[model samples]
Target: MENDVLRNIALSYSPMIDRNRAVVATRLTVSALRTGGPLQADQLLAAIAEVWPEGGTRVSLNVMSETLLNDLLRAKPLSNVMIEIPSFIACDPVNTDAILQLQGNTLLLHGRPPSMLPRELLPRFKYSIVDLADDRRRNEVAGQAEAAGVTRSVGFVQSGVRTTAEMEASFGRGAVAILGWPIEDVVSQSGGRAGQPDMAVLVELIRRVDDAEDVDKLDAVLKRDPTLAFQLLRYINSPAFGLSVEISSFRHAIMLLGYKRLKRWLALLLATASKDVNMRPVMFASVRRGLFMEQLVANSGDEEMRGEVFICGVFSLLDRLFNKPFDELLKTIPVPERVYQALVESAGPYHPYLELTKAVETETAPVINEYAETLLMSLLEVNRAVLGTLTMAAQLE
Candidate 1:
C-alpha cells in the first residue's frame, strides 16, 4: 500500500500510568485527518497498527466524516482502542445510543466542555479530555468532570505549556492521564544549586569517571557511594544485560562493561538521580533515542563509531537533565568535539545519526524515509531498530 497517509502520523504518549496501571498508552494522532479530510479505512488502520503494534491505542476522531465514523463504530475493532467523538455527535440521541451499544468499548469526549456531555451518556465512556489550559477554565472543567463523576484528564493539544507544578496540580485535581505535553520540558531547574556539597560531589564524580582509565581508580570512586555501587551492580545483573553468569565483583563489571560503557552509565546515573515523576518519561525517551542511534551505527559496519553515536544519543538531553545549557555544561565535561558538534551545531558527521534518531520520534514517514535513505537504510531497517530500542528500554525500566 502507498505510504502517503502514514506521513502525517505522530505518536504521543500518556504521561501518567492508566487506570489499569499499564505502562503508557501510545496515542496515535492523524494530523492529516485532524482537520477533516478523506481517508480510506484500510490505510488509516494500517498506519495505526504500524505505530501501535500492540493494541490499546487512544485515537480521537473529532473531524472524521460521518460515513467513516459509522464504519469504525460498527466494526468495533479493538476494545483496547479508545474511540473519542466530539460533543456534537454525543448530543445526537441516536449516535449516543449506537456508541453505548458497543460491547465494553472505551470512549472519550472531546471538542466540548465536560458539562455539555449528556449526564445519561457520561457513564458510557471512560474519561473526559478536559481543557484545563487556563487557571479559571481548568478549575471550572475539573469541577464539571467531578460533578459528572467522570475521571478528569487534560491534554496539551491546545494548552500552550504546562509546568511540573501545574501537572502535579492536575493530578491532584483527579487527572488520571495527561496527554501531549512533556512533563520534563517544564520541570524547574531549582532542583540544582551551585556550591552545594552533594551537588558538587555528583558533578565531580561525573568528571572524574569520564577521565578515569584506571580500573582501581574507577572501582574506588564507585565504591565511595554504596548506593551508586548497588545500583550499578543491580543494573549489570538485570536480565537486560543477558549475562550467562552473574557479575559479582567490581573487577568483573569493569571487565564486562569496559571503561567507555562504565563512564556512559555513570553519566546517565548522574543525569537520572532525581526521583521526579516527570523525569522518568524524559529519561526513557533519551535512552530510547540513544539505543536507536547506536543500533543504526551498529548496522552500518562501523564498530568503533558505535560508542560515539551511543554517547551522542544518550547525552543529547543534557540540557533537560542538568537544567543548564548543553554547551555550558559541556565545558565542565570532557566530551570529544565530534559529539559536541553533532549535539550543539548539528554539523558533525555523527549529527545525521542524531537527527535520524529524533526523526523516528516525531517526524513523518516521508521525512523519516529521506533520512533513512541518506543513512543507507530502509523503512524495515528503521522499524526493526525502533522495535529493538523499545524492547531494550522496557527491560531497563
Candidate 2:
C-alpha cells in the first residue's frame, strides 16, 4: 500500500523534462515486520520498476535493525536490483558480512563514521557518504581514505552544520563537499564560522582598494583571501571585457583592470554575499534593471544620465536586502538627487522604466503592457529584452 501511494505520487507529478535517461530514483527501508515473506520484497520492487523501469530505478534499503539482514539475505531473488547499505550497519557482524557479500552496486554510509570492514571486503562495491554534518570528522575520513589509496569516489553531504572553515579545509584537502542547499545558503551559514571573511571586512577591503593610489597596496589586500583572489582572476580573464592577455596574479590584474573596474567587481561580490534563495530572485531582478537602464541611457549619448540610471536601478532593491523600506535605505547610500527622486517619488526621467520593471515583477500584466505601449515599444520586445537581461544577471554568481 505504501508502494502504491508512492507510485501514484510519482505519476501525478510528471518529470519537468522528458528524456530517455533516468535521473529520478526511489529509496526504501526494510523492516522485519514487513519482511515476513519473499512476496513483500518482490511486490515492492515490482511497484518501483513499474513506475520507473529497470536500470532506471534505484532502491536503497536502510538497515535500522540488525535482524532485518537475515530477511534481506533470504530475499535473494531481488539481488539483481541495486540496494544501499548504510555504513553504520557494519556495527553488527552478521550484517557486515552480508553487506560485504551482497554484491550490490551502491553503498551509502551516513555521517562518515569510522569503518571497521576487513581490507578484502572494501574493494567490492562503490560507495558515497550521507548526512556528514561534522566537518572535522568528514575531513579526517576523506583524508585517511585517500591516503590509504581508496580510489572509489567520495562525496560529502552538506547538512548545513559544517562551518566555512570546515568547507575551505575540506576543499583545500581535495574533497567534494556536496552543498545540499543553494550556494547562497552555504555563504550565509558558512560566513565567519571557518574564518571565512566577514561582510564588514569585505567592505573594508573594497574601501582600501578605493583609497589606494598605487597598485601594490591593493594587490596585498586582494591576496588576503584566496577565494576573492580567484574571483578577481576569473573576472579579468572573462571574454566580455575583451582583454588581450591572461592575468596571472592579483597584482597584474590590478595594474591592468584599473581601480574603477576593480571597485565594480568588488561591488558585485558584496552583492552576492548572501545565499538566501528568497533574496536571489530579487537580486537578479535588480541587476537586470540596472544593466538595462544603463544600456538605454548610454545609447542615448548621455554618459552622466547613464550612471544615474544604473545607480537608481541597482538601489531600487536595497530595501529587500536590509529588510527596511526603500526610502529608509536610500538615505544611507550617497546617491545623486535624480536617483533619489526616482526611487522616492517616481518623479525623475528614469522613474517610468523602474515602475515598468516593478510592474512586471509583481505580475501586473496589464500595467506592463500599458507601459510598453506608452514607451512606443512592442510588448513582446520589452518582455524578451527584460527576460534576457534577467538571465544574464542570474549567471553573475
Candidate 3:
C-alpha cells in the first residue's frame, strides 16, 4: 500500500522511466521518509527501483544512511552517484566504510578542517573538495587528495592569491576548477586596473579602425581584434546580404564595402556588450523588434530599405543603456533620415512598422494583430519573417 502511494506520487510528477524521474522520485521518497515515518529499507529500495529501473541495482554507497544506506549498497543499482559527506559524518570510520561500499563516482567533501576523511578511506574514493577557505587551502587539500590518488577538484569560496594560483595549478593538473563568479565579474570589480595592457591594445585597435582612410590600415587594425575581424568577414561573406566574392583582407572589405556598411559593422563591434542576465532579455527584445520591423518594410515593396529599418529597431533600446531620450542619442550616429524620423517622432514612411515592432516588444499582441489586419498581412506570415530574421542574427553572432 505504501509502495502504491509512493508510486502514485511519482507518477503524478512524471510517468517516464528516465534519469529525471529517478532523481525526482528519490527526492520525494527521501522527503517523505525524513518526516518521522518508519519506512522499511525494502520499501524505499522498491520505490527507487520502480522509478529508476536501470539505476536500481547500482545505488551509490554514500547516498543513504542506516537501513536505507545498507539496502542501497546491497542493491548496487547504479554504478556512480555524487555523495556529500559532512565533516562530522566523515570523521566516523564506520560511516566512511559504509559510504565507500557504495562506490560513488564523485564525493563532495563539505564542512571545515579537511582531516575528517580518514587516511585509509582516501585511496578508495574519487573526491572533489568543496567550501574551502581562500585558494591556499584549496591547493593544499587538492594536493593532499591527489597524493591519496583522489582527483583534486577544488572549490574556492573567496577570491585570493591562493585561490587564483590553485585554479591555475588545477588547470595545469587537468583538474576541474569551478569559479564562484565569472572571470568577467572579477575583472569589472577590479576596476579593470589589473589588465591595462589588454584594454590599451583594444582601445588602440578601435582608434586605428576609426582613423583608417585606406583598406590596408583598416585590415591591419582589424587583425588586432580577432572577434571584430571575424564578424566583419562574416558580414561581408553572408549570401542573403553579402558580396559574391570572398575578400582576402579587411582592407579589401573596407574599400569594396561603402561607408554605410563600415559604419554598421563598427556600430555592432562597439556594442561588444556583455551578456548579463538582466540585459539579455532586453537585448533579445530589441533584436526581435528590429527584425520584425525590417520584415514588415521588406514586404511593403521596400526590400532594399530593410537594413535601415533594422537599425532603427536595434537603436530603439539605446535609451535604456544611455539613460537619455532616444532622439537625443541619435545625434551621435550618421543614421539615415527615415531611421531618425521613425525613432524620434514616428514621422517617417517606416514609422508604422517601427510602431508595430514596439507593440510586439511590449507584448501588446492585440495592437500587432489589428495593425497586421489593417495592413492586409497575415499574422502568421509576419511571425515567420520575424523568427527567420532572429535566427539569421543568432547564426551571425
Candidate 4:
C-alpha cells in the first residue's frame, strides 16, 4: 500500500534543528495529497516510519477526514511520528475526542489553541508548530501557548525558519526546535579541514579517480584511511546498493561498481565526511541531491552525464563543508567540467539542473515549476525523481 500510493506523492523534508544546531527531528512535506487521492494516513506514516525509524519526524499535514483521522490513530506506537493539525481540527470537539486517543508523541498544533479547548486536552499536543514565515501567525501563536494554559511537552517549534537570525530569534522566544535547515548555522560553526582529519585521504583518492588510476592504486590510497574504506564498504553493502554478494573490501567494491559509479559514491562520502553533529542534516540533503540529480538524467542513456550530475549535486555543498570557496577547492580536487562549471561558474549545461535541484529542496511549487519549465521537464518527471531518490536515500541511510 505504501508503494502503491508513494508514486502519486512527492516527499520533501527539512531537519528540525535545535539550539545546539543539532538536527533533532525531520519535517517531511508531501507535495500532493488531496490532488493525488484521499490521503492514506496509515500508509503514508508507515512509509515515514520505515524511512526515518530513529523517530522525531513531524508529519506536516493539515485537516484529515474523520476516516483518515481514525486511520492515523490506528498508526499507534509510531513513536517518532508527529502529525500537525490546524487549529480548526485540533479544537473541534469531535476531532479532539479522536486526537486524545492518539498514542506516542503524535500530535502537533499548527496554530494557537482556541480558548474553547477543554483545558485537559491541551497537553495532548507534544509541541505547537508556529510558522515563522507568517508574522501574524507567529506573533499570534508563538509565545501564547503558555498563557493559554497549554502545556506543550516540548516547547514550540518554529516552522519556516530559513536563516541563522531566525533560529536565534526562535530560541530566544523559547522554541525547543526550529523547522528547516540550519545551513548558515552549520557553516558558521563548521571546523572544515581542521575537524575532518580524513580530508587528505579523500583528496588523494579523488585525485586518483580524476587521473583514472588503476583499481590497485585506488585500493592502496584507500588503505591509508581505514575509516574511509569502512564507510565506502558499508554503503556498498547496504541494501540500497542492491548487490547480491556482500562487498567485503574496497578493492572488491571498486571492481564491482566501476570507477564512474564508485566516483559518485566517493563524492557522497566526501560531502558527508564532516564530524560535526550539526552537519548531519547537510549530509542528509547531499545524498538526496546527488540521487535526484542522477535520476533527472536516468533516461538520457548517457551514464557519464548521469554520474557527473550526481557529483555536481553532492559537491554543491563542498564550500560549506570545507569552508573554502569553490574556486579554490576545484583547483585541488578535479571534477567534471559540467560539475566544475555549475559549482564555480554557476553557468553551464548542468547549471539549470543544479538550479532545479536546489529549487526542489525549497519544496515551493512555483519555484520548482519555474525551474522545471526552464529545463523542459514535466512535473511528473520531477515528482518521480523526488520520490525515487527519497526512497533510495532511506535505504542508503
Candidate 5:
C-alpha cells in the first residue's frame, strides 16, 4: 500500500484525534540512507507541531542507520519536539553523557529490556517509552521500568494488530501512547475459491434485482440472516434517516428504500463482515466513507448521484478486502464507470466526492476545509456527518 494510504488508515482508527490521553503518538517516515536528500529536521518538526500541538506528543523516530542518527542529533528542536531515544544508545559508553544531555528535551529510553539499561543511566532515565510485544513481556518491562524509578508510556511495535480487542488490550496494559500500522488484514482467511458465504451474499444481492420486483426472495434472504435484518431495520430507523416512524420489517424497508437502496445497504453489510479480524478497521473506515459521501450527495438533492457515491465509498477497499490488486479485482466486479473512476484512477465527475472522503479520514483541518469548499459543504456539515457515521457503525455492531 502507498504510504499516504497507510498513514490515513492508521490515523482514522487512532484515538489521538479524541485528545483525551496525556501522551500522543507522533509518526515519522524517514530513510536513514539519505537516498533522497539530507534529512530536513526543521521541516519535520514543523509538520509534527502542526498535527500534534499538544506538548506531550510522543514521537517514535525509526532509526534506519548510524548516519541518520547523527543527522537527527545535529538538528535543533524548534517546536519543543521531545525526541525519544532507544536504550541501546547507552550501549556505547563513549557517548553516554552526550545522549543523557538530550534527556530533559525528550525521553531517554524507548521501551527496552531492563538488562539492556545501564545501571548508571537508570538514575538519569526519568521517563521512558515501554515496549509491549505481548502480555508477559509488557508486564516484565513495565515492572522493571518502575523499579528503576522510571515512568513509562507504552506501545505495540509488532505487526498484525487488527481487532478492537487487540487495540484496547494494548491500552489496558497502561499504554498512555500506542503505535501500530495502518490496520489491514495481515492473516489470510481459510475457505474457498468463491470466497466466504457472507461475501457471496453481497454478490448475490447485487446480481439479483428480482428481489426488488418480488419482495418474497429478499424477505427469505433476510429471514435466513436474522442479524442482518435487525441491523438493517436499526439503520433505517436511525436519527440520521430522520424517519418519524420506525422501520419494523424487511418488506417495509424495501417499500421505503426500494430495491436499489436495499442493495446498497446489503453492500454495506458485506463490507463490515470480515472473517479476518485485521480487516475490521478497514471495513469500519469503508462504511464511514460511504455514509459521508451519501450525506454530501443528498445535500445536492441528486438521488442517482447519492446512490453512486455510497457505492463508491463502500467498495473503495475491495483491493484490501480480497488481498488482490485493485485493478485486477475491478475486472471481476461490475460497478458503474463513476465508481471505477473514483476507486481506481481517482478521476471523473465523482472524483471530487472521493477526495472529500479521503480528507475526512485524515482529519487534518487544512485538507478537510479544502475539500469542503470544493463540494460547497461547510466544515460543520462534514464533521457532523463523520460523527454520525461513527455512531452508525457502533449501532450496527
Candidate 6:
C-alpha cells in the first residue's frame, strides 16, 4: 500500500500505563500522516492493526479530518478502537452526527471531565484524556488531595505527565490510567548511575552461550536467578517469537531460538535485567531501539553486522542502564568494536542509525526527514522499520 497515496507515515505510541505501572493499552498518535493528504480510514486502521496486532490499541484522531474521521467511523470494522477526539472536533456538528448515528459508539475520548465540554456533552464521553498541566491550573490537586486524599475521577488517563511527583499527584487524584510513562524523569534521577546485568549467573550464562555449550548447561546458570529464568521464558514466549507451544524451561526456549537470534535477544535482555521496577520504560525503549536499528539495516547488512547493530542500539543507553560510564560497562561485557564505537564514541556507521532511531522516537517530522535523507533511505523505508519495530516490541511486552 505504499503507493496508495500514503508516504512517510510516522507513528509514535505511548503506553497507557495502569496504576501498577503495567501497560494496559497503548495510545497511538499518527505524528506524521501521508504527505499527499489526510489518510483514509481503511489505510489508517490497517496500519494500526499491523503495528499492534494484539489489540488494546487506542488510536488518536487529532491529525484526521472530521469528514474522513466520520467516514471511517461509519465504515470501520474494528469497533473496539478507543477513538480519542479533541474538544473542537468532538463538538463539531458533522462528527457528532456521525458518532451519534452509531448509537453504541459512545466511547468518544476528549479533554478532562468538566472541561470546555458543555455540561450536556458529558454523558457521551466515558473516557477523558486530561493534560495534567492544564488540569492542575484550573482544579489544583495541590491542597485538595493531601496526605489522606479526596475522591478522584476514575477512567481518566492523565497526559502531559513527565515527573514522578506529577504521576503520584495524578494518581493521588484517582486517575485510572496514565497516558505515557515518565521515562525521562526517572532516567534523569538515575543520571547514568544504573544497574547492570553483570550478575555472576548472567555473566556465566553469557560465557556458556558464547562458548557454544549445551542448552542444559545454560539452564543451570539461569536456575540461579529464577527471575532471570522467567524473563527468558517470557521473552521467548512473546508473540514475536512465534513458538507453537509454551516453553516452560529456559533450555527449551534457548534451543528453539538457536544461537544467532538468542544472542541478539540475550544482548537486549541483559541490559534489562535490573530489579528496579522504574526502569521498565527504559528497558522497553532499549529493546525497541535494538529492534528498530536492526530492522533499519536489515536490507543492507550481513547477518553478523545486523546483530552487532542491534547490540549497538540496545547498548547506546548502556550508561543509563548500567549505572556506569560506557567505557566502564563495555569493559565488563564483550562487545564488538563497532558496537563500542557507536555506543561509547558515537562515531561509526551504526551511529547514524542510532541518531535516526532517536529522532523517530520523538516523532519530530522534520528531524526524522533530515535523518532519513542523510541516510539516503526513502521515508517509506524508514517508516516501515519504525512501524515494524513498534509492532515487534509491543509483542515482546
* lDDT assessment of candidate 6: 0.68
Lowest lDDT 10-residue stretch of candidate 6:
54-63
Model 4 worst lDDT window (10 residues): 55-64
lDDT of each: 0.59, 0.50, 0.47, 0.73, 0.57, 0.68
Tens-digit lDDT string for candidate 4 (1-397): 2254454445556667778876665566665532556656766666666555644333444323444555565556466667776776667676666777775656777766565666667788777788886534346566586778865354678887765667777787788888776576567765565345577788888889877798888888888889999898888888877889998888787778877788877888898888776677678778878888888889873988988998999999888888889999898888988888999999998998888888767666566677777888766677667756766876776
TM-score of each: 0.69, 0.43, 0.43, 0.79, 0.55, 0.81
Candidate achieving the largest lDDT: 4
TM-score-superior candidate, 1 or 3: 1
**lDDT (C-alpha) at residue 397 in model 3:** 41
Instruction: Order the candidates by lDDT, highest first.
Output: 4, 6, 1, 5, 2, 3
- Candidate 4: C-alpha lDDT: 0.73
lDDT of 3 by residue, 1-397 (tens): 5343232111101000121111111111121212234434566445444433554322222233344444543444434333445556666665766667656444545345445567766655454433334334434554575677864434322212122333344444443333221222222232323123333343444455445456675566556657667765775576535467887666776678755556555544333333333233334445555656666766565544866777777667655544446677665555678888877887877777776765543334457666666667665455545445544544454
Query: Which candidate ranks first by TM-score, i.e. highest?
Result: 6
- State the lDDT of candidate 1 residue by residue for 27-122, as single tens digits: 433333232354454555555554444453444433245655665666644555567666677777667667777666667766565346667687
Higher-ranked by lDDT: 3 or 6? 6
Better of 3 and 6 by TM-score: 6
Per-residue lDDT over 106-209 for candidate 5, one digit per residue giving the tens place of the 0 to 100 score:
54355455345655666554445444443454445546766877754333332223434555555555544444433443334312123766666656656664
Can you list the residue pairs that collide in candidate 2? 165-194, 184-275
Off by over 4 Å in 6: 1-8, 32-34, 53-74, 102-120, 137-155, 187-200, 207-220, 237-239, 242-260
- In model 5, the runs with Cα more than 4 Å from the true position are 1-181, 184-194, 210-213, 328-333, 373-381, 384-397
